[model samples]
Target: MQHIIDMISNGTKMNESEHDELINEVSAELVELYEIEYDPDNLIPADDETANRILEAAFDLLEAVGVYSVDTKSVFTIPRDEIFRSVQNSQRYLNIGEGSDKYLLTLAGSSEKKKTSIMGGPNASPVTPEMFIPIHRSYAKYTDIDSIAPAYLDVPAGSAKKGPANLMKARQAVQLVKEACALEGRPDMCITTPPHIEDPVAAVSVANPRFMGSGDLQEIIPQQGLKVNYSELSRVYHYKMTGSNYLCSPMLVRGLSAATPEQFAIEIAAEALKSQVVYGASVFFKYPAHIHTGDPLKTLWASFAATQALSKNEICLQGSVVTSSAGPCTEMMFYETAVQTIGYVVCGCDILSGPVSNNGSITNQVSGLDAHFMAEVSRFASDLSLKDANYLCNELFSRYESKLNAPEIGKPFVDCYDMNTIEPTQEYWKLYETVIADIYYILQQKNRRISRR
Candidate 1:
């Protein structure tokens, strides 16, 4: 870990333009080296050859360009040999929570029959202090979710992004999640994430053992397409120094930073490699979001390719979240979640981290019910073959592909769920049941076809 810190402080210095140029140049070279091609039809490949090629491509990218340090204006390069050694020596499983609630989260593979652990919350969605406890309590009350990520307090009095005020709010958010978990009779439930605070002091301060439990997972998010800033790096350093568990999250944009699907896959694999070699994190979570189209298929395709690569080659635990274009109470939202969840699980993800409704845009637009569905789908897909899982994804994607662009904004939490009872309203419940039934019907049909074959 000290080696990582040293590299962060003292690495090859480069300007932003030079960094970008390096990425573009190396990425282009890797595409040719690997003979990478985008297949819109086979979003999730079942074979080992594709996965191996992607893993190798990622290694080449790391050896060629290294990770750019946005804070130090430098690049940290790891030798290919060291990168392989780190991955070979990486941790394969993480034990989270405590006592009876404790869960063993291991690396998932396309062929593995193990159920992935579910992490639920609003995913740092906006919530007033008043709504924070009740909203989180609702999520904790669900028996299916293995962990929780609480919503950030969108305080009305002051800015929630800086200074002592932000620190106070960040601490408050962490305490509120603990309180909510205790209230729901699951005090040991693994809590994930502090509030999305920007102040480095506040961010690092909230991750201490006094506030965050040892079993809980903190986060270190690099910027899109293999860039790490000081703020996130400091948080990871704090967690490591304090002996806490942390997850490395990296996002890849489909066309913006990644340029193409092949590039997107390469970047995610590279980030996953860096998570172990540089960040020293055991769990890696990454997602790809499309820049132009609201359709998540392209994003899902790129992510599935990358995750399959990592799942096959690395020992570290891996996962991705279910982030839909539409908000809750819409069929599109459920459809999107099913597709994303199935893709991630079948391609090899150890944890199911979300159902970030409304693309995590609007405040109070998330629900425990959607997260519940994500968990259920994850468990169901755990035993499925990659071909069957791909079939289900294709079926669900066809249902809502056209609706992606004009997704319904839907209602906020107050309108769809009863805060007093901490349960979804009758209308929302009906939608939930209807969507579940529709999916089961598709699965039933799929099974029938398989039997006939």
Candidate 2:
């Protein structure tokens, strides 16, 4: 924490342009210098050598460019030696939740014996107060799901996310998730910290043993393109003192600072390495995305490549988030979730988080069904080799490629799920079954295709 403070107080100052220029220049050079590669034909390619190369390039990028402090207008660079030592000594296994609901999160390899930890929920979808408990209970009821990543509570009718309302809402969000878990007979279920309030003070205040639980996962998010602020730095200190499990969640937009999938993967790996060393992040949440769309193929490929690199190098426990373009209750969403889930699990990510429908934009547009299907796919993909996983994802992508641009934004949670039973309606269930069967058929054909080869 003091080192972080020192970085802010004494680091060399640079304007936004200079910082971006340096990032761009260093990123371009690293890509060429390391011969970073991405196979568009085979998104989830079985290439460990390339994966290891990407990880090395990521470390080089960090040592050269460092992390930019948005608030301080300064750059905080760590030496390669320190980065290596920090990663070597960082936490690898994390125990979250308690008793019956407890689950282990470890930096898993691509072994058939490993079980991918599942964190299921609406995943930050906006929701009214009336729908919060029911939506979360639907996920908490699942025995396969290890943790709950609840939806964001929509601001009270006319109020904004500030003042006492913000603090109250933050506390309320945690309590509501706990209530949902208890209702489902899983009181010890791991509950992730929600964005009830954007203010760091209220966020931090509600994040205690009482609200979010010491065993729950809290996220310290970095700003886009390797940037950090005072708020996140403070949370790192607080979580450490409270002995809470936390993840360093970083977002990479493909076209923002990173020009291509290869660049994006490098940036993602660099951020993961830096976060593990700097924040002592118990886990790393990897989500590479396009700024405006949902479930872009290139973004998903980038996520797999980065995760493969990190997992291969044994950086930290990595969690994969599946943000779908389509909404719940649609056939397209089922396909989207399956493809993303397969890629992530094949890449050896330890945790599978989401299938957050509608790109996580629409209010009440997500359902437990999406989470359930994602879990199913993740479990099934655990035993799949990279070759099989690649064939399956490519086949699924081919079916949905044309519909990627204008996927159907299906019904809200209320429409597709029976609130009384907290289960999917018959129509939604049938669609899920149909998609599952179709995916299996595609896998069967993969066998024939391989034999023909």
What are the lDDT figures for the candidates, one per model?
Answer: 0.80, 0.82
**lDDT tens digits by residue: candidate 1, 199-296:** 88887787777888778888766776567776676777777788888888766676555566788788788888888887778688885644226435
**Worst ten in a row by lDDT for model 2:** 288-297
| lDDT of each residue in 257-285, candidate 2, tens digit only | 77777787888898888887778888888
Please give the range of 10 consecutive residues that has the lowest summed lDDT in model 1.
287-296
For model 1, the stretches where C-alpha displacement exceeds 4 angstroms are 5-10, 157-160, 290-295, 447-453
User: What TM-score, computed on C-alpha atoms, does each candidate reach?
Assistant: 0.94, 0.96
Q: How many backbone clashes does candidate 1 have?
A: 0
Candidate 1 accuracy as TM-score: 0.94
Error of 1 at 427 (Å): 2.0
lDDT of 1 at 134: 83
Candidate maximizing lDDT: 2
Give per-residue lDDT, candidate 2, residue 135.
Answer: 87
